[model samples]
Target: MQVLIANHGAYLSGIATTLWLCLYSGVLTLVVGTVIAGFRVSPLTPLRAFGTAWVTVFRNCPLVVVLFFMAFALPVLGLNASYFVFGTVGLALYTSAFVCEAIRSGINSVPAGQAEAARSIGLGFTQTLGLVILPQAVRSIIPPLGSVLIAMIKNSAIAGAFGVGGDLYMTGTRLSSAQGEAVVPVLIGVALGYLVITIPAGLLLGYVERKVAIAR
Candidate 1:
């Protein structure tokens, strides 16, 4: 209680930083993941293999390792950036693999006939995916996408440990240690900060799911 009161400003800053990370990373994840999902489902063998390899590697690799590579290794390779950039990029790339799978699963849930019909009407692969298949596939995509986003929110905490400052995890733990406060309360506050983002997201997902179901 005292800890929170004393550090409310820090906590707020942390939350804002976390949100910034989430916003950028989430956008990147969706964009890259969607493109990769297209690759996974593409008619071209090379595209499919490349997509498969992407998912296999990133999905299997630990998040910390990815962050480590992004944070430490990239600068050595001439890509100098802030810790925030590295963290955001790492989070996005790692999460994108899961997003790709979710989208692929949704795409696969769509019937083959839909693609065939679209092709018969002279739709190219891109047109078929965008105009015909994806609209139908969206219903199945939501639940998994929601789950993945929630997981991503949780995963963002790991970024703090890797020198991404001003995030909730870093703020809470650093303040607690510096002040010699109880770790539990500080952590609880951190958890609540996360809930501030996630609970609303869950509710939003629920609302969307209901609307999608009704539309179906």
Candidate 2:
């Protein structure tokens, strides 16, 4: 398309930035979500409440508001960072609640018998999760985590609207504005760019899911 050929450079940069956003946000979400999921699954009442509060608050809040706070409000509290950092952190925080829930669901999907059996073997709660529940939870965890990563790619576009530079959605919007009547092409380019990441991720995770599926 003329729009793409004329602005391939912008598209390339946008695609790269989108990928970068997905990378850092996805990794941080997984790590923090695991901890929160652990908390949700913990035997301690306080820990469970803390995890519940975290997911309830963040999950209910709109992501753009969270990003705006991270970018604008954090400076007043002396927690300033670059736009990329703020954007990545906001995306991670917003997405992690869902990740925590997904992982918690996987943890729940693990049979009650496993925990009881672990207890019968005298294993403590933490040990039982690390040794028994989580490892087996891996089968269910993969599919949801893949979905999270895909969602992150789409959500990362929000960063550009907030003035995070080099974002694909921003690039497409800018090109659309410049090209006058080619808005459709610009948007299609963005969609294809997103699919570039999500499609492969879906395939890989599907393969992994098939490979690790437990006979149930």
Candidate 3:
């Protein structure tokens, strides 16, 4: 109500910040995750081992610890950057583990005979994976990938608490605690801001899933 009206500009800025964080982190997550998935499925034992270690560590470790390390520890080592950069990297790396697992599951779901057939035609490993396997696997990957991305959107709120200000969570905090706005109304606005992003995402993913299912 009044709280939202008064802070409309702030809310819009917060929403934009959240979107930027999600965009940067989401792209990185997919890129890193795809690479890790390839490593996990590679013929090289060393690559597979490295990929396994990556997923095991990042997936098992608490995200707060990862963000803390990125935000705090890296600066001490002279890798200084803005909190936004650290938050984006931490979020991406943490979420990439889950993305890797989802992609790996999709890879596993692809029929073995397809890969064999590709190889029989003299396609190399990379060629088979890039041209044949991943294309087919993408159908299965999309649903889980969408779920992971949605979860990542929610998780971005935590980054605001860790000094990555200018996000919806920080906006609400500022309004409620600093500006003396009623907590409930401010929180309602914050929830709506989140829904603005996530609901559309969920619906779009649903549509894509249905379309892919039909094509399959």
Q: How far is candidate 3 from the true structure (C-alpha RMSD, Å)?
A: 0.9
Q: Least accurate stretch of 10 residues (summed lDDT) in model 2?
A: 172-181
What's the distance in Å from true for residue 50, model 3?
A: 0.7
Give the Cα lDDT of each candidate: 0.94, 0.88, 0.95
Any runs in candidate 3 off by more than 4 Å, and if so which?
Answer: none
TM-score of 2: 0.92
Supply every candidate's count of residue pairs whose N, Cα or C atoms clash at under 3 angstroms.
0, 0, 0
Question: Model 1, range 100-174, lDDT digits (tens) per residue?
Answer: 999999999999999999999899999999999999999999999999999998999998788889999999878
TM-score of 1: 0.97
- After superposition on all CA atoms, how large is the RMSD of candidate 1? 1.0
Using TM-score as the yardstick, the better of models 1 and 2 is: 1
| Cα RMSD (angstroms) for every candidate in the order listed | 1.0, 1.9, 0.9
Q: What lDDT does candidate 2 reach at residue 98?
A: 93
